[model samples]
Target: MPGFPAAGPPGGPQRSSAETYAQVQASPEFAALRRRWRGFIFPVSALFLIWFLAYVLLSAYAPGIVNTRVGGSNITVGLLFGLLQFVSTFAIATIYSRFAEKELDPEASRLRAEVEDSL
Candidate 1:
């Protein structure tokens, strides 16, 4: 246990970790951070899910369209859609990384420091 990280502040009469986190969670800054997170995440997630489901449904119920050759090239509509899935995944990751770095990280760092300082 000597080298192991602490589970939390040493158990005592001092305030519980939950109370501290609850304080942070109740803060307006935390609320805004959460809003920003949910705003970006929920819509993007829904859109991506819709895009993926459309592809799957098309492949299942509309093979002719999915299998159609694009511009006389060997690439089929299904192949293009499949490739777009990978593209969209990478795009989303990149966007999230940028958003977190630009917007979330600074606020989160400040919040963490506040908690640590309070401890």
Candidate 2:
């Protein structure tokens, strides 16, 4: 096959998959890429979870607050908070897309190239 590695002689092994994986995992570029990914993902995930929990808790324990009118309008605090959830979700997606484009995509591409070359 064009892309597949050549088969070894009968009863013989070809390249070690473990060794190939270890080499890729051991690369400094791969390490840095992982660190950068986790650095952004963990904190953002925690923050969003906290924000969502807060909204849930407030709705469950303090209906009065959430139900309060907003500036004498038909809108309620709970309604706004629910809408804000959507807003925050979209905002986070946008921010992450930008982050990936600026901070992650290039490094990821390089790492992919390295892996392909190794293969």
Top-lDDT candidate index:
1
Quantify all predictions' global Cα lDDT against the true fold: 0.85, 0.84
TM-score of each: 0.85, 0.84
Q: Candidate 2, 105: how far from true, in Å?
A: 1.0
Error of 2 at 43 (Å): 0.9
Measured with C-alpha atoms, the lDDT of residue 5 in candidate 1 is 24
Q: Please give the TM-score that candidate 2 achieves against the real structure.
A: 0.84
Error of 1 at 34 (Å): 0.3
lDDT of 1: 0.85
Tens digit of lDDT per residue, candidate 2, span 1-119?
A: 22224335668776666666676687777788889999999999999999999999999999999999999999999999999999999999999999999999997887666556545
TM-score of 1: 0.85
- Candidate 1 residues lying further than 4 Å off, grouped into runs, are 1-13
